[model samples]
Target: MAHTPELSPSQPSGSLHRMTAPALQPTETGTGTRQTQLLARMLLTPAVALLFIWMIVPLALTIYFSLLRYNLLDSESAQFVGFENFRYFLTDPAFLASLQNTLVLVGSVLGLTILLGIPLALLLDQPVIGRNIVRLMVIAPFFVMPTVSALIWKNLLMHPVSGLFAWIAKLFGAPPIDWFNDIPLFAIILIVSWQWLPFATLILLTALQSLDEEQKEAAEMDGAGALSTFIYITLPHLARPITVVILIETIFLLTVFAEIFVTTGGGPGLQTTNIAFLIYSQALIQYDVGGASAGGLVAVVIANIVAFFLVRIVGRNLEA
Candidate 1:
């Protein structure tokens, strides 16, 4: 064995202390905070810069095109026409009809989903056999492609002559109802609600599962009725999740294209054309790029307005 080196009084006694002393000593708090902040900013810079570019480029292009008298049919005649495109797009007779249809479609679907989702979520939350299978079945519709779902509804379910609904009606001595022909907007709403119902149910169920069991137990122990417990405890717990669902669903619903496309084709007349379909018609059908861009900007503004109100609701719920 090698002889151990003798410690010197003038130097540190132990290698461990020599190694760890500097590290273990308190760092300057201000210096550490500044270092942490700098590192965070450096890490965040790339993501922030990427997001900025992504949002800014499209917005800038849209603004630029919206101000021009650009048409795919007459590309050589393109000229800057400060808001003339916007004025024309807004003043179009189809604009009012499409706006009304959009409002109706969005409102009806939101109401139906929320009304149906809560009961479904509560039902699924209870103890039952094959609960997992039931949940998977319920959620399966949301995973189906929008176009496929629309076609399924159109041909298999809502078809006046040869559909399941028609068969059901015939069985009960009732005449088959032509869903799209009689109630086109409602038919669209029904299909959209079916597709979105699963999403709302999943979100609400998760919220239900996260509920504090002890509070529920306490409520029961205090002689609270089922309705009372739900009204007070369950409903309050669900407020935030409901707001989240509404916000997310509204954003997607604002741009619903596929279902309308595959089913009604935006009409028997212009009856089913929402703002999105109107914009599509302007750009692709009518070959008016400037008009479409202006319509797109209007859509953005409407979405932002709705989002602002929904955010306020969510914020209040969070605070409470």
Candidate 2:
């Protein structure tokens, strides 16, 4: 300044002082951020890798096989057919029938499960003695293997001559019905529902338990009847869980095979045949790999469509 009073060597010029030493390296924060990113990637890698492998491998194989006229019985005869199998399946009467049966089976089970599950959940939510024991009993069916459940219903509960149904019919002086023959689809539906009802009940019951009791009390204070409070408050709270249950159950129901396989084998006349059973029959019994792969792809498409709508509906409800 005025001959800038001789600045000490220790005092730098203003420009030199203003110039920052390449910002002191934030070693700790930088290292921590890098380490955190690495740890997250390491943790997520396995699941991502597994899903990638699982999806890509089978899906690639299915697509490849769908284009070829492959037969399990005669590999040498394999040739590229490119959508012929899909065309055949689309036009096949048996395939169409199986699709119908699949829809019916899924619809029937879904309707019955929701109807029964909501009530069962409501009852289980009550402060009754041994409620936990009852809840366990209700969920027991879901724990049973599908094949075992089907067998139990077929042999012990629905068998015409010696089953419980027969015994009960006899007691009432009524004829024993051949459930598998007269209403084969209905029999399969019942078995599937019995197995899935427990799942629905468990989910809905958990949702019911988490409901806000203060809301119920407030409604009660407002002179709302029990029915009115449940309809307005409890039902709204349960809608999400119910949607989840239905979506998950539909996925399982669409691929239902073991119960139908063990119970009626998709017969008396393909009356209970579903897409899964149809795919099995095409691949194994007929040894038609191409057809089976096409059917499998179709099934996957239908399932995805249903899932898409269900997810969208549930997401909208959640946002609301």
Candidate 3:
């Protein structure tokens, strides 16, 4: 009783898809690239909007408030005084000290990390027993929270009376040196360098692993000594990574705050105070919003300047 449907065995298997292909065409004008670009823009719109709200809006507010004499403690309304906050912040002697401390901290940590990380990375790269365990132990420091690490270094390690260093000093019949009190800036640098050293090592080690083995073997066959191989081949290979480490580390190092805040409290009388701590003192301790905002803007400008130069350097290295 049913009418038999004719089998179309000669027809292409994708015949249905071919018939429906026109329906799947993008509504947007132009070719595949245009549609893809439109889709990408649509996907990115939310992220772009969120970024503008999060970063740009606050920055604009900071700029606006920087122009006003706004003290959080003062009951009086904010009064507009263009460039006065900037002038005051610049003239304040603390700013100079903070600037110098910032530079020193960044420079010292960078130097320490690079100097130590290179050798550490080389050692880690070599085939050895428990190499994986050694790497894990070495990288463990980086995972520790900055505040926690500062506390550990301060109370457990550096404490003059009841700490590990004090015990070691006593064993050697040398009087224990007070770390934070005697050399506050150095203590901060040490703490920060400890935190960042693993990052440098990890990056350099990864770069080292990607190095061509044949080249090193060839160099050795040609009578290149270990030091010579390092100088001629390894160091040159590491140049780009080193620049990258410097650039990235410098950016975050410019805002070194937590270690100083936790360990030194920017103290023994401003010895460890950097730009970031100075801003915190202004905003929170002194309760001068305008001054803090101005300082913040100054920090922004300095960071931009540093980044500009760093980017130029990195671009040249990349080209090379």
Query: Distance from true position, residue 263, model 1, in Å?
Result: 1.4
TM-score of each: 0.85, 0.88, 0.87
lDDT of 1 by residue, 1-320 (tens): 23344432234233435455566644544455567668888999999999999989999998899999998988999999999998998998889999999999999999999999999999999998999999999999999999999999999999999999999999999999999989999999999999999999999999999999999999999999999999999999999899889888999999999999888888978889999999998899989999999999999999999889888887665544
* Order of quality (TM-score): 2, 3, 1
Candidate 1 has an lDDT of: 0.91
Candidate 3 deviant stretches above 4 angstroms:
1-35, 309-320
Top candidate on lDDT is: 1
Please identify which of the two predictions, 2 or 3, would achieve the higher lDDT against the true structure.
3
Clash-forming residue pairs, model 3:
none
- List model 2 lDDT by residue over 1-320, tens digit each: 12343433334333342344345355654565567768988999999999999989999999899998998978999999999999999999999999999889899999999999999999999998998788788999999998899999999999999999999999999999999999889988888899989999899989998888899999999999999998999999998898888888898789998888787888988898899999999999999999999999999899998899788987676544
lDDT of 1 at 285: 92
Of the candidates numbered 2 and 3, which has the greater TM-score value?
2
Which rank order by lDDT, best down to worst? 1, 3, 2
Separately for all candidates shown, the number of backbone clashes (residues 3 or more apart, or on different chains) is: 0, 0, 0
Candidate 3 local lDDT, 121-175, one digit each (tens): 9999999899999999999999998899999999999999999999999999999
- Residue 87 alpha-carbon offset, candidate 3, angstroms: 1.2
Global lDDT of each candidate = 0.91, 0.88, 0.90
